[model samples]
Target: MAEAPTDPSHPAAFWDARYAEPGYAYGEEPNAWLVRQSERLPTEGAALVPAAGEGRDAVWLAQRGLRVTAVDLSREGLAKTGRLAASRAVEVETVHADLQDWTWPVEGVDVVALSFVHASPLFRAEMHRRAAGALAPGGLLVIEGFHVGQLVYREVSGGPPRADMLFTADLLREDFAGLEVVELEEAETVLREGIYHDGPAHVVHGVFRKA
Candidate 1:
């Protein structure tokens, strides 16, 4: 079993184990929500994907014509991402780092898409603020993850072990207040990412645009 996030230490082990499994923990396909938001994803310019696992989303974005950089704490996962990118014949820059401490450039990217990156309350807001700061004007941030309501479905869908680490629409609005709310909502949805995340789950998804 993967270790629960004890950040700066445990998360690396946790994710590394998950990715070292027989296949991609979240599958080889891009996130379904990300695919739905593809029309808005920039076909050019730079894109950043933090907490990228197995490079599914990063490779997809690269195939879409973006110069993509994928960041993750697990070297194993990054390696898988590199392999996946090569299999797709696309280029993706991989960075080994923790998003909580990593400093991204201001207005340095045209797109920032994150999926299932559950942050602890201790630095969740600040992390989100940093994500907002990384966006150039008119840049879009597409994100989705288990909502606080996922607690009830935890056994079935599997999300952050701690409720405090889960998100709500209100919390996201407050954290990313600097960005315009293109779409924000909490809803019940079915997940079919991989062996781990498969069930009817409650999630909060949003698309925020920098003005």
Candidate 2:
């Protein structure tokens, strides 16, 4: 994967260093599957993107007229987000905080986008549940991430080191219990994001709506 997260003791520092690199660590463009599901997003409303690394997705949402809040533990990542947002002439509220401790806006947002966020198994369910709780009635939560099957890709893959950090449709379905499942699938896709995430990837993609 991408350099096996250097400062594991302080994951934020690791991410900050990665984002502090010369160019967008994962590329300037939003994740391909996210763009594909954009039509399902609210036309005008609030969106919360946790672990929003470099703001590609947040910027895209803002461009489409959604008020977006992009949160991450890495200050450098959020700073890159600000730079990218400004470059695109869009406004994205950047929050620098660990998602675990941040006060999520409960039932206040219209959408939540989680793309390639590799949460450890211990935190994954809690994270997804909180994100789902933040959605308003009928609000949507769209996610795309590496599946456990991605382990086969090994060094060529771009996901969490531990298999538990990966995702499965069943896991997500159980985690988002109160939401109606609009879509869920595990599949293989060719990724073209940047140096960090470029290769064949096994992924889980899902779109769930709050009841």
Candidate 3:
């Protein structure tokens, strides 16, 4: 992946430019892995989605009858999310903010879902902590993204080119330390979402439940 800009406003500016391009960066559908794990998700509850680019995952959650909140740094991306929600006849609350600096809710949501948010290691750890803390009792957190092994396929993996941003099963277990690991694994798979993630890939998929 490209390096996030260093200037304070550059991250948003950069993402705005990216999302401002022609089509959805990833796609307009929920992640395939998330779809497979949907049975564990509550049909009606509040969900928080961080780094919800173009709101596909967030919009999908809303379609499932959940009140969903999607937070992202790019205003343009959120705008697209709103349009997508309108197109789907669903509602997704879009929040424009930087995850690195935002205060994550504690015990306030029934689900927290993150997909392919490849931030720098420190911010990534913080986001994981926020995700774990956001869950209410018996709440679930679903995260799926590129495995560290994807570095080998950087040319076509569609993951961050940086190894620190990529993940391993152990990394996730450590990041979400307090949650109960309902399922955690890493494997090879094919991603056929959009122009962004379209190829064979190595990935990690996990579901953690709060007690």
Worst 10 residues of 3 by lDDT: 1-10
**Cα lDDT tens digits for candidate 3, 9-47:** 377887788789888878899999889887888899899
lDDT of 2 at 29: 92
Best-fitting candidate, scored by TM-score? 2
Query: Local distance difference test, per candidate?
Result: 0.88, 0.88, 0.87
Listed in order, each prediction's TM-score against the native is 0.95, 0.96, 0.94
> What's the true lDDT of residue 89 in model 3?
98
Candidates 1 and 2 compared: the better one by TM-score is 2
Q: In terms of TM-score, how similar is model 2 to the real structure?
A: 0.96
lDDT of 1 at 195: 74
* Deviation (Å) of 174 in candidate 3: 0.9
Considering only N, C-alpha and C atoms within 3 Å, which residue pairs clash in candidate 1? Answer: none
Per residue, candidate 2 scores C-alpha lDDT tens digits across 1-211 of 3546444478987898788888988889988888888678777999999999999899988888999999999999899999999999999999999888899999999989999987767788999989999999999999999889988774785677778787888988999888999999999988888788888989999999988
List all candidate RMSDs to the true structure: 1.8, 1.2, 2.1
TM-score of 1: 0.95
TM-score ranking of the models: 2, 1, 3
